[model samples]
Target: MSGNSSRRSPVERFFRMSLYVFAGLVLLQLSLALLAEIWPWLLGIGIIAGGISITVWWLRHRNTW
Candidate 1:
């Protein structure tokens, strides 16, 4: 056999990228959640903005992937 590999489909690639983004966001949110205890207003705004951006991204890409 050969060692060559096939390229991933666009949808598969997009899904994998999304997974990575989701994981990073989860970590970021976790840290923000912890910091929120110290600065509730600032961290709360950051969290809300992050949530909105994530939701918009999902809505736009959901049909493509």
Candidate 2:
């Protein structure tokens, strides 16, 4: 009766895990909502940055082939 006194029951553990998952989802939703207005700008910057990086990488590696 005392071997696992600190361990939670299976049902309690399941509910705790579910609560954590629910909280994570809520936080994700809130963050996405907050970023909704800037999402397009962020995407555009990402695309431009990615293109520039790729071009630079290609220029540096082109002579290897």
Error of 1 at 41 (Å): 16
Runs in model 2 lying further than 4 Å from the true structure = 47-65
TM-score for each candidate, following the candidate numbering:
0.45, 0.57
lDDT of 1 by residue, 1-65 (tens): 45445767899999999999999999999998887777978778899999999999999999788
lDDT of 1 at 57: 96
lDDT of 1 at 60: 93
Candidate 2: C-alpha lDDT: 0.96
Model 2: per-residue Cα lDDT over 1-65, one tens digit each: 79799899999999999999999999999998989979999999999999999999999899788
